[model samples]
Target chain A: MSQIFHPSTNTLSKVSIVSVVLLLGGLGYGLLALNRSPYVARTKIPFDQPVPFSHKHHVAGLGIDCRYCHTTVERTASAGMPTTETCMSCHSMIWTNAPMLEPVRQSWATGKSLEWTRVHDLPGFVYFNHSIHVNKGIGCASCHGRVDQMPLVHQENTLYMEWCLDCHRHPEKHIRPRDKVFEMAYQPPANQLELGAKLVKEYKVQKLTDCYTCHR
Target chain B: MKRLPWLLLIGGSMLMMGCRQDMHDQPRFRLNAATDLFGDRRAARPLVQGTVARGMLKTDTALWSGKVGNKNVDQFPFPITREVIERGRDRYNIFCSPCHGLTGHGDGMIVSRGLKKPPSYHTDALREQSVGHIYNVITNGNGSMMSYASRIPMRDRWAITAYVRVLQQSQNVKVSELTAEERRKLEGAQ
Candidate 1:
């Protein structure tokens, strides 16, 4: 009342209001950008497995089929991990004394499994089946990117709900011949949409939009 | 006004943190996790004795085990229809052809990659071996071969055996045994 307040107090209050609004707006945008970034989503971040199994060496260089190790991809809910037996089938003779494969040999000898870290993990609520996808003509490369090129495996797709829905809604765009499911180098033909449509009918693929299709 | 924005920011972050606990701390047993509620201390319960799961009752020994009275049967339990053979071909290509080779030559891609090369099915030893032996190998796994029983169902195992027979026959067909029409086709192709 007695000139205690500065003459510029009103201007200071106005500036404070403008700064607060700008800060909040920037915060929201930053959060969204970070959420969608590959860094946060863990795409292309190679995980350290117990054994440094290289998809590049096995699948690309040696030309081993995906089904050789992932034996249950076409028949089970999960693409089963290879047993120690599967690894030793070759390693027993090929790289018997390689220090890198000592863990594999130990696991085989002790009958204990190597604890390989999983890369593409979905949340508990989400339900995904490798067999259904493979049997319905989804090529390994469609969702996994060029795994044959990666020396160490990494998550290629965001694996977010929105990412799944994109393919689920327009599955024809992703579908390939069933024979090509394991083909790492498969590419969509010029008439992919047409081929996809034909396959959708032939494979009887349900265009599932309900939450239960995946969530349950 | 300055105090109000600071309070709002703190409250929003607190609210977000509160929501995290519900899903992450939900009561559930993870695979092979230990649990005190069970006597075995295993989260996974053992199947009750004599309780067979639905669609898993293996009453027909021949169909399920490819054997009759502890001896491997020479014949398939079911009729070898064309469709069954085709199904066998598909299953064989996926499962058996990896090691046995598409032509049963024991020269599958794996063999070239330096895994042990299995004996060729075209060899007289394997050609004369009973179909049941092939089926037994698939079900129980032979030396250096992993058992495919878990990966391939019993019916598909039979189908694969049938396809292996087809492969063996393809490689060892006699010119005199060929039908007149088949002989003509072979001559023309040659």
Candidate 2:
């Protein structure tokens, strides 16, 4: 042995043990942080669009109905995006010369569509239908949040699988009268559970937990 | 040998991150993205000739087209029920009420904001027109109005036509022709 190793070697081994433990703890935290990050969840982050259309100004300020622009929500699978014709139907007269609306004006003039960036984008495999949800008395505010309050639209909820399952498992907590679907300020009454049960039956909402329901 | 387990743990975590690429960057086509698989270089395939999609046969001329031959049918293809009228009211309020107003006065919120004014349903011109004529306008559109054929189904279009007639009658009713029950209600309000 002849004193070949330094006396500090004993302390060095102890330090290495502590470092290994800390590294494992850091990895666990990093995974948790990534899941909650804005990149993955995308809640409350306004995405950039070709035009900065404000839902607040149109919906809250002017009292325009959501169906006024998203015209096919009640009838089709997709809540159809407004065409240039829809924008020009109002902007052609009102705000005709505003520089802020230049992209809208150009789209109208060229007969080209404004490439709007989608906010609440689901993965390709998710089979979400706007008509089924809307026709079943699920209000616009149920998933979209208070869109009328947002100056620029943003995804308000996590829109995760767990979040959707929470509502699907207990739809009575969320269901409302069909007439109130567009009402952004609608609140579930004190007897919401009773009302929801009645609506769940009336709308024939089945408890959808099968993987094929959403995945297919 | 002591450091080997530590290195393996770090490498394993890194490998887990790489595995996420398969689901996120899946082998699939974006909507309307260009593809070389087809001669047209489009990802979407054109419908085959003589192939009809489900529920889109359009064989019923009066039901689907609002016409029998060249003329618009004077009556609804199906009987107009109370439930049908309510559905029509809902659809009309969502679609037509933006331009035609809830009462078909052509003074909708859009018109107040400066879109072209539609003709009032109570006008002599519109009131005298056949039910088919009104349905034709809704199916094909007329003047500044855009065709709602795609947005509204055939049954709903008929329902809306029925509701529009009800609106016209409401505004153009004669007091003398009112039933005794209706007259009593009107006098009670006074």
Per-residue accuracy of model 1 over B1-190 as CA lDDT, tens digit each: 8799999999999888855745533477644455678664657686789999897899888889888888988988999998888999988876667666788898877777676888998889888888788899999888878777766778889988998898889888889999999999999999
lDDT of 2 by residue, B1-190 (tens): 9999999999999989865756544579754445678765657686799899898898988888878999988888889999988978877887788778989999888788767787888889888888888899988878767667766777888899999988998899898999999999999999
For model 2, residues A1-216, the per-residue Cα lDDT tens digits are: 588778999899899999999999999999877876777799889888788899998888767789878878887788887877777656766778889889998977875556677787677777788999999999999999999999889998888888899999999999999889999999899999999999999999999989998988
For TM-score, the strongest prediction is 1
State how far residue B116 of model 2 sits from its true place (Å): 2.9
TM-score quality measure for candidate 1: 0.83
Best by DockQ: 1
A53-130 per-residue lDDT for model 1 (tens digits): 899998888776787678778887878878787786568767788899999998888765576777887676777898
Which portions of model 1 miss their true places by more than 4 Å? A1-31, B1-9, B15-51
Local accuracy by lDDT, each model: 0.84, 0.84
Fold similarity of candidate 2's chain A to the true chain A, as a TM-score: 0.85
